[model samples]
Target chain A: MATVALKSVKKSYGDINIIQGVDLDIQDREFVVFVGPSGCGKSTLLRMIAGLEEITAGELKIDGKVVNDVPPDARGLAMVFQSYALYPHMTVANNMGFALRLAGVPKAERDAKVKDAARILQLEPLLQRKPGQLSGGQRQRVAIGRAIVRQPKVFLFDEPLSNLDAALRVQMRIEIARLHSSLAATMIYVTHDQIEAMTMADRIVVLRSGKIEQVGTPLELYHYPANVFVAGFIGSPKMNLVPVKVQSAGADGITIVLPGGGTAMIPVQSSNAAAGSAATLGVRPENVAISADGPIAGEITVVEHLGGETLVYVNVGEGPFITVKAGGDSAANVGARVRLSLKTDEANVFDTNGAAMVPKVRKPLADLEKRGH
Target chain B: MASKAQKKIGLAVLGWVVALLVFFPLIWMALAAFKTEIDAVSSPPKVIFDPTLENFNAVFERVNYGNAVFNSIVESVGATLICLIFAAPAAYAMAFFPGRKTKDLLMWMLSTKMMPAVGVLVPMYLIFRSTGMLDTRTGLVIVYTLMNLPIVVWMLYSFFREVPKEILEAARMDGARPRQQLLLLLLPLSLPGVMSTALLSIIICWNEAFWSINLTASNAAPLTQLIASFSSPEGLFWAKLSAASLLAIAPILVFGWVTQRQLVRGLTFGAVK
Candidate 1:
């Protein structure tokens, strides 16, 4: 029954404010991830919830009771640190049973609980070995096993897999997803890796410069970013934002002139944008296609063949270099001229201030409120 | 290639020569300890002679050797244990939760050691006299503990700093209180450092001569005073002085030899991987 709530939480160090007025609600059994670039206050927010950092000017509630002044152990929460923080001197079994021992649990019951957690983490064989003797992945499992023995209402992971190799990270990612389902505990994870946020989060909170840029489910952030920052930050190969001029605005949509003398009327609300003003058009790499009669044309500067998919970097006049995700068998070569067709239904329009003009029609999967649970 | 090999052999020979030169005085003293007064002060020192136990017997017969040995043991060991009890927690706080002024505070504590012992000797004597602490084992223990506190704190602080803060935080999250964390986690992890710190402290307190000579009389006089007693102004009895010196240093030398490995290991800790 862990439902964590924060109201106007703020953290400051004298004149320097690390977290500025953050409000969030994490529901029970939901895997929420706070993600941003470095120094974006994501880890600070997680620590505040763990009762590690003080909430300077806000109320934090866990299970409908204010726990702002509670000590970390009294909050009924467990944390897995980035370094895995295992006691190097203790055996795996003792490390897992330390909290139970402190709670005055009998030795027989403590051993049973430790064995159960070790079996769940597949660490039964390594129970008697010290942390230094275990490999990195095994030590990681021991750290998680320690957390699991406590059986806290909430689990907080601060970049738990950031230390693993690539293949191990993927394997551990799947293992964590499995653990989430098996335990059915509310979890809040913090990471700078956007791909982890996209894959593992039931809801992603994107933070930048101590403030939340946006919060939504994975596909919603992918298909309907709130502004230019979110649009550029949340996708692979990045969304291509090309400068354009506003030609006209009417009931149908707003018409903008592209770089290569092409006009496209994207269906977006332009209430604050006047005709003939400057604007930006955003298109995902997957949404841009190469065709003979396409409106915009550019010469391919570089082609990256990634086994199953190829990315084509093109230059159209003096505008920003745009990327196109094409088939693996793309016949396009460097220095070859290609025409690009923008998918208007999938296009996003932004005014001069970089604020995304609201879309008139909703993307079905992008509306998380309307989705069936 | 031949020159490099010759150079290596030459350096080894030179090292042995320097070591023997440094140990010559001790060797001479040990030899004299087994000689009569005439043989000890011979014009050319006696290299080979009929060695006798006369000097050792005379030195022991003249002084309360057993009481001095016991006093030395009790004062040195007691001072070291008490110093560690106070220094460990102070060092833990300074290492783990260092405020902006921590460096300054450490430097100040070390600066107290830089002042010569004689500079404060008169004042210390007056205080001891007024407080009825002069010529007592407790008085000597207090002085020795204070004398060794700075170095003990500094060494323990550096060792404690080597432990990662994450481990302590993890202990806190695991519901271990501060005292338990110190007892169960930190002390065991830094056992080697703590052991070497204790060894160094014991060695320093055992060998302390200035305070032992100035503050103590018959009842609390340690081996240092015993050794000094043999050097009377009536005449220099070289053989008996040598025997007393040998007696004073034998126990510490054996202790040092037995624990040399741990001493070297602790001193050079964190230098390599």
Candidate 2:
């Protein structure tokens, strides 16, 4: 319904800055997720947009109007806190209708709105129950219902699924995604879970230490992280980064000596750093495969079997052991030597300053995000 | 197994013994309230005696206790109401909107209670005397309200802290301003703690002897001063004193008996994590 924008928004207490100059624009009906580790100012940024926290030194505009000084209630927004923040004394219906009641909406209209939200959240059966009487997932739904009933310009969620168990988290994640599509309202979600961001966000903003590292579609971030931090933070089982000595730079790519005395030509623009210099090679575990004739060889240190896939940790003698993803039925065990091959075009090279070197030609993956697989 | 049973029995016996020991004075007083003066003073301390209503009759005839009772009720109950009105908001600010100095401020508020009230007696007496409030219920109410404010605020602050900060933030997001947040949400949620603090304040105000004794002669004297007034030049009138003690404690005992559960829970609930 509305676009939210932050321009050079800074949050600081005395000299200790929290959100250090964040500038972003969220479009109408867009589901944007701010993803980062703890203490990364993601929640603070969400709160700043919700007007729960003041913009320290920058403009915050909602729907093209500067709302830097507007109180939270006046800002036309709602937030679902990690704890749900459900009123323990109120029934589910009352909890959902509270903002309406506070705004002096008539009882009939308030009840109708509450009923509508409850139906959407599948909380009709729980209308008469207090928050304490509900399960964790039910409480979470009620919290979302509370926010939804407000019908604010933008909905803010601060780690809403953090309290849910894994199975419930997945269920709730899909439900929330469904809610976003149905409502078609602008949403800003803050979470430390990369999987949640990747699954639900139209655009993901990766942040670290109060600064935005990169912002892109999830697949874009997955395939083309701008820096080492975004690459490391976006993937689970993280992208393996190994220190390598650059052998040569050419029109084709830069040839680098891999961690375990193997050589690979990474297809990225060199921007001309002299050969024999050190750089980092970035590779995802899924791209690293075990083959008898592969160039790099290392002993398997640990193996994690997840029913559908196995993760084999290999001690490659130079880096924090490179991990290789294998089939669930693979018989890779600790202490076995495995030769590894990589998808050369997919590999990335980072200079010593942790900036990913630009790829010469971008691979055009068609409708990567829309593909169910 | 036998030793466990013995230990259980031993604990029960010990508990009862301690209970009786603590209740001995009140039991003796209740007994003596029904005894004749001579019997009450008997060296053996009469456990059983011919019960008479003479001491109660004497108290009724000698003292016009209605005025004292009214004064006690008005002063204590008035101070408690005012205390609630003033203290709840202060506690809310301290608990929910805490600053870097909140802890220091709480400690400072509590520290005011550490200085003896007697230390400020002469100045307070002079101020009251000059202000024409020396023996008035208004004066005592004012003093009691100030006297109990720090503790009430402290109690209410702790109670308010037990509420999740997110609930208030939700209320704020829901468009409830500061006053509405306090009245609609916080007060209802912490009703038990608020009630316990009020009861404790009332009891403290009711039993306060030093202020009432020092500040009043007859016009605004409460049950405490009335009980003290029973002391005679001849000797302590044991039966009459006992009768007045029972009379003074009767209403408060009932008040406490009705709401003692809240008092216990509010105080001890937060003692642990």
Candidate 3:
């Protein structure tokens, strides 16, 4: 297994810049996922690392050796494409054994390696079948098996589960997570699916327009997003961003007025923000609670029932719709008047420039200091 | 529902009318070939003449039908093979590894076919005569190969284009070299298309009347030229000529029958995704 470092990598097509300068370090044996919406350069970054695409600028190094000029084969990496790019003409055994065969391994060794990989992927019964005969999930297994047999230092998966049905995707996602632990190889997975990034990645690299918006553990990004984009992207049901203007500034905190008329004071430490300036207040849908007596009132516009939980979309006065995740058993009817309250400690404050301001809680640091050295 | 049955009947009647119109000449020719020379030229056209093998005997004797048939088979098949040999690689390069001017180059190649064959007949004949290729089987094969090359390349190029580039890329990532990609991936994927194009090329070469008739006297004369020879100095030799014409078309008819589905499928391959 090898650590991969991309230093100031950038990509462009003529005048259109696809990926601006991006620098990231994927430590050895860590499962790093690059997640973003389509056209956000997540796949481009993975392709660049796989050496499938040419690097327009900067250096990429694998295991501390500069490898910007290396071809894909020489990069010591194997990629499982979104399409599962299995050779249609080859049987499962040959597909998995291709790299070893190409490396000139003898027949006995090749068969053994393929058989072992087949066992690992539960593909023994599929060894003789061509890729066309396999279902999507099975083809994906063969694609993964193909990568596994290569035994490369790094495994790159480019949205490998996107083509499967929901159940199969979940099953395969877990299988891949298990594979990562079993192989202990450095793996980089790219997907637009946030839940996959949250559940599988050791470090989730959130990219937007070719720049790394944030790079941290999944919870770190979930609890402490670096910007409004990451905040809006990382969470399920999306973060409700309400426009606000600073009302008063003091050492203790800043009071900001919401778009419709209400004011809420939030403690945040940021040098750039000032009183009488524009900022956005972000609250995740799940963090917003509906109460009988609450600070804000709105008309319930829609409610999305998702079995265990319900997402209530509400229009407060004149502001944009704010969504709140409520109990599934609670019948929150549309067009009903409701009062909502923000979970302050879980809320995110952002400047007009879309930079997230970290919430300043008073007790955590002091408690840590008091408990230990 | 009532009109639907009438519509079906109307369509069936119309279909039979077209079929008979097409089959009438062939039926008359078959009848005439069985008649004596006197009956063959009868004014009212005898439909119930006594059938005989006299015309067949006359044909085999008067013209070397066997040599012509053999030459047609050899030249057509040889030309088809030669066309395929050159077309496959040219199509491969054009479809996948295209250079900057490749589109223009393809257009230029196609434009060569657009030019009437007779427009270059004089030059081609002079070159063939000078080179002593005027009446040789090898010369006919070479000419036919050239004649069919453009269509062959065009067909194969389109077929190659239908194959997903990802398949080739997957092969490359699997460590297949260029030659292996061609032999292992492209050739197998495009088998149906190549077979159809080969069949079509052979049919075209077999039916090529102008070049075969103009260039060959006896030595390399194909079935088309053989059919032309049955036209005597008189204005018409309908019965004998029709027999030779039917003989010339029979092989191609059989070939078309065997691969008809594949041919239609291949021709329409590019019209869809």
Q: What are the models' TM-scores? A: 0.95, 0.94, 0.89
The TM-score obtained by model 3 is 0.89
Fnat value of model 3:
0.39
True contacts kept of each: 0.68, 0.74, 0.39
Please give, for residues B1-273, the per-residue lDDT of candidate 2 as tens digits: 569889999999999999999999999999999999999999988787999999999988888788888888999999999999999999999998789999999899889989998999999999999999999999999999999999999999999998999999999899989998899899999889999999999999999999999998889999998888898677899999999989888888898899889879877868878
Query: What TM-score does chain B get in every candidate?
Result: 0.95, 0.95, 0.91
lDDT tens per residue, model 1, A265-322: 8998886789889988999999998888888889999999998999999999967898
Q: Least accurate stretch of 10 residues (summed lDDT) in model 3 chain A?
A: A364-373
- TM value for model 1: 0.95
Q: How badly does each model clash, as a count of residue pairs?
A: 0, 0, 0
Candidate 3, residue B98: the lDDT equals: 85
Model 1 spans > 4 angstroms off? A276-278, A366-373, B1-14, B270-273
Model 3 lDDT tens row, A1-373 = 5999999999998788889999898889989999998999999888888776789999899999999888777888888989998877789998898888877999999999999999999999999999999999999999999989988899999999999999999999999999999999999999999999988988899998888999987777887788989988998888898888888766656678875677777777756677789888888888888998667788999889998999999999765899899988878999999888887777788988898886687333322242242
CAPRI accuracy category, model 2: medium
Task: Tell me the whole-model lDDT of each prediction, alpha carbons only.
Answer: 0.90, 0.91, 0.87
Listed in order, the DockQ scores are 0.71, 0.73, 0.40
Ranking by DockQ: 2, 1, 3
